[model samples]
Target: MPTHQIQIWFTCTVDDFSSSTLAQTFSTINENIQQVLNPLDAICHKPREDAICVSQLRNAKKVDEAILQERPDVKIFLPFRFLFWKPQDLFRPNTYNRFLAATGGDHVISLIDEISFRFPPSPPLSQIDDLPQELFCNGDNRPADCGPNCECVHQVDIPLNAIVEVVLVDEVQSPNLSHPFHLHGYSFNVVGIGRSPDQNVKKINLKHALDLDRRGLLHREFNLPPSKDTIAVPNNGYVIFRFRADNPGYWIFHCHFLFHIVIGMDLLFHVGTQHDLPPVPPNFPKCGHHLPPITFDSGYH
Candidate 1:
C-alpha cells in the first residue's frame, strides 16, 4: 500500500465560494508525495507523562503522589485536553446538538474527580426483567444526538442475533482521558487499541501473525484476546470491541471511571426483540426506583 502513488486535483471558482474563507483553507495544502514511507510501529503506545496535562502538571496533588507511588507509569487521571478547534457535529440541528457551544458548550464537561458505583446488596443486577425498564435504560430507544451541552445521551437498540462493533473513541477534544470501558451481559473481542493520530488497518484474525506479534507491546495490540469484561482505552488513544447480540436484554456499556458516566460518558445496547425479554422473577419484591450513592475522594471533587 505504501508504494502506490495518488493524485488529486481540485478547482474552486469565484462563483462557488467567498474569496476570504477559501484562501485561508487552501493556502496550507502542502504535500510531499513519496513512493515509499516508513513502516508504522505495529504496537501503539500511550502518550508520554510529560504530554498528559496541557500545562505540564506543574502543581501535584495528593492523588498524584499516591498514583506515583502505586502506578508510577500513570501521570494523572484526568480527561485529555482536546486538539480540535471544536467538537464534532457542532452545528447539526439534531435534538442532540440543540445545546452545544463552540468548544463543546461546557468547559467542565469531564472535570469531576473520584467517583464510585454501588448497587443494593439484595437485588442483584442479574434480576434482569424484574427491575423497571428505567433501571436499564433511562430514555426510550431513539436517535439521541449527544453534543454541545448534552448531559446525557440516548441508548441504542439492537436486534437479537445481530453483530455489533462499537468504535469508542477519546474524541478530538478530550483526547487525554483513558477510559476503561466495561460491557455488561456479554464479553467482547477487542480488535485493537492505538495512539496514532492517523491509523488505518483492515480487520485481521486473532490467530494470524499480525495478531500474535501484538501480544507483548505495552501500547495497542492488533489482535487482542477476548476474555475481559473491561479494558483500558489508553490516554490520547482509542480502542474497538466487537460483540454478538445473543444476550437478549438491555445492557449498559460504560467507562469504568464512575465520574465519566455521571457526566454522561455512557451508552446502552438493547439486544433482540421485545419477545426476547424474559418475564420478571416470580417472587420478586417491589420497591421504589433508586439511584446509587456517589462519593468523591482525594482532591478530585
Candidate 2:
C-alpha cells in the first residue's frame, strides 16, 4: 500500500436561489461522511471564507494555497499533515466529506495498505454493488457478462505482487490522443519514453502512414519504479515497464476506448503463480483463457 495526501480547497458561492442546491450538495457530502466514517471522529467538515479545506494523509500548505487561489470566494486554508498506523486509502468512500462535498467526483488517494482494524468484511457482492455497472456489467465492453462469480470461474481476487512486463511503443507524429489504455488489476513501473525527429514529415506527396512504433528521438524521460493504478504513456513514443501481479484475479488489460476496445486492442493477463495457465474454455478459444507471452518488440508491421 502507498499513500499520497491531497488537499482540496474549494469555494461554493451561494446566492438566494443557490441555497437550495447548496443544501442538497451538503446533504450528499454529509451522507457520504456518515456512511464512511464517524463525523465526530475521523472526518472533519469546516467552512473557511467561501472555501473548505480537506486534508488526508500528509498535509501541504502549498497544495492548499494553490487550490484556494484558483478562485476568489476562497480564503485562508491549511492542512495539518499527519501519518497514521493503519493506511486506509483516504480515497475510500466517505472517509473525507469535505473533499467530497467540494470535488463531487470519484477521486481519492491511498493513505496506507489495510485498514487499522479488521471489521466483519463487507460481503463481496455488497462491494460489487458499489462499483459502477459499466465496470463489470459489460457496458465498458468488458467480458464480465454478469457480475463477479457469475462467470464460469469464480476466481475473483487480484494479487498485489504478481510480476508483469510491459512495453509501450510510439511512432513519430504530431501528438494526439491515440488510445484509451488501461492496466489490468495493477499498475506498473514507468521506465521511460524517448522520441526521435522525423524529417519524413517535412516532405509532402510522398504518402506515409503514421507508424505508431517508429522509435528514436530521446525527448522527455521518466524512470520511476512500479506502483499500482494508471501510469501515463506519451502520445508519440514508447514506455517500458515491469510490475508484479501478486493479486489473483480476473483482470482486463485494454485501452480505455469505449468503442475501440470493443473492436480489438484489448487483451487479458492471468498472473497466477509460476504454474502454467489453466486450459482455455472449450467453447471460446478466441477469448484467450491464458496469459499472452511477454515480448518487447517494436516496429511497423
Candidate 3:
C-alpha cells in the first residue's frame, strides 16, 4: 500500500472564522511544499556538473537508469530542486551517553503485523531435494522453529566500497512524526526528489507500471540537488539519495526519534568483505546469545 500510493493531492480554501494556530500551520505547510520545487527559469535548465542521475530503482526487478535515457514518453519525473531537503540535526555531547545508554541492545519488541505475500503461497513444509531440510522450513514443516511463520528482521547488505543509491517513500503511518533518517558512518548526496504518484487505491496493482512512470519522471525532473548525512523524509513523501559504501562496518540507518526506535524502525548495513574489515579486538563484549556459530574462514559469516 505504501509503495502503491506515491502521489499527493490537496485543496485550499479560506475559512470564514480564523484560528491563529491553524493559519500558521497551513502557511508553514504551503511554504515547505513550495520550497521543494525547482525554479522554472530557462537558465535553471542548463546541465549540472558532477551529478549523475540513478537510472534505476534497485529492487528485485532491478529498474535501471537506461530506461530514463531510452524512454521519452514516461511522465513520472517533474522538475525538482533539493536545496530545501537539508539536514537540521544538532549535536549535543551532554546527552550523548544518556542517549547511547537508552538505546543499548533493546530489540525485544514483538512483530505482530507481519505477512508473507506469496501468490498461491507454498506450504511451509514444501521441500525440494538439493538444499538442507532446515534451510527454509523446519522439521514440523513450519517455516522456522517458531512454526510456519517466524519473520527475520529486514536488512540490506551493501558491498564494500560500492556506491549505494537509496530511494525512500514515506506514508506517514504515524501522524505528526517525520523520520529524520540518519546513517552512522557516511553521508549521502540528495540527488533527486519527486512527488508521489496519485495514490488512488484502485491504482495500487498498477504499481509496476506506476513505478516505471514515476521513476522516469524523477529522472527528468531532477535539479539543483544538495548533500547531507541526515534529512527529513516528510510524512507521506519520498526522497532519493546516493553514497559510497566505503564504511566497512555494521552501520545503522535509523530515525532520530527515541520512541520510534524502541519499537523497531531500524536497518543495518554489513558493508565490505570480512577481509576488508578490521579484525575484532580482543574481548569485544558479547551481546545476548552471542552470534550463531559462524564458519567464516574467508571472512565474517
Candidate 4:
C-alpha cells in the first residue's frame, strides 16, 4: 500500500502563542507544515485598486481608492486562544460592489440601539401608538398599564414577499462591545460591514451610517454574501444585511445576549398582517388563566 502525502495549513495571529513552550511547538510544526500567521493579511491588508460603484443608482461614480484604503484592519477574537482580550472587529464587507444591482431590495429597515431614540433620558418602552395588544402582552395577560398604546413593545412591520435590507448600527455608548443579533424565522445575507473612515467620527450610529450611505461610502456586496441567522455587529462599526420576507407571522429580532435581551435590546418584526397568517387550528391549546368560580358551601365546617 502506498501512503498519500497530506499538506496542513495552520492559521493564527502573532499573539496566539503566549507561552514559550507553545511558541516552540508551533515553530517545530511550522518546519514540517505550512502556516498562515494572519489570513486577513492576504485578503484585506493590501489597498484595493478597483473603484466600487453602485449599480442601482444611475450614473453613480466609483468610490475613490484612497478612501477605501483608510478602512481599519479586520480584528477577530479567538475565544479558545485568547479569552481575555476585548471583543474585536471580525469582518468587513467586500471592498467592491457586486450582485446588489440584480437583487435590489423592496424595503430598507434600520436597526438601531437605544441611543438612536435617546432611551436613557426617555424610557426604552415603545412610544408608537395603535400597536396590537396581543403583540405587547406579557405572556398571556396584558400588563395593567399596557393598552392600545403599547408602551412596552417595540416592533417594525415588514410586508410579506418583500426583499428587506437592514442597516444595523452599534450603540455609541458601548463602542467596544460586539452585539450578536439573531432573527428568529429567516437567515439573512450579510452584504456589508464597515465603520466610518473619518477619524473625527468617534462613534458610528444610525445617523452616521445614513450620512455615509448618502455620501456613497458604505458599500454592499450582493454577490455570494454569507447567509446567516445570527451575526456579530462589529464593535464601533455597522453591518448591513438583506433577507426576503416571505414568512407571514410575528418574529423577534434581538441580541443573543440574555442580559441584553432582558434589558430591551430587541424588537419584533411583525412580518405581514394577521390576514396573511393561516387560520388557527380548531380546538388548539390556548394560553391564559382558567379557573372555576369558588363558592363556600353552607354545610361545610
Candidate 4, 74-128: lDDT as tens digits? 2111110001111121123532211111123311111233210001222112212
Cα TM-score per model: 0.43, 0.31, 0.45, 0.51
The candidate that achieves the highest lDDT relative to the unseen native structure: 4
lDDT at position 79, candidate 3: 14
Write model 1 residue lDDT over 231-300, tens digit each, in one string. Answer: 6765444455455567886576767766555544555565776567766668767554466787778899
Full ranking by lDDT: 4, 1, 3, 2
Assess each prediction's global lDDT (C-alpha) against the native.
Answer: 0.41, 0.31, 0.39, 0.47
Better of 3 and 4 by TM-score: 4
Candidate 4 pairs with clashing backbones? none
Candidate 4 global TM-score: 0.51
Candidate 1 to truth, TM: 0.43
Please identify model 2 stretches exceeding 4 Å from their true place: 1-162, 171-175, 197-228, 273-301
Error in Å for residue 89 of model 4: 35
Clashing pairs in 1: 80-176, 80-177, 82-173, 96-145, 100-148, 100-149, 160-272
TM-score of 3: 0.45
User: How well is each residue in 59-118 modelled by candidate 3, as lDDT tens digits?
Assistant: 222222432232322111111111111112113343211112223332222111121111
Give the poorly placed runs of model 1, Cα more than 4 Å off.
1-42, 45-107, 110-147, 151-153, 172-176, 197-225, 287-301
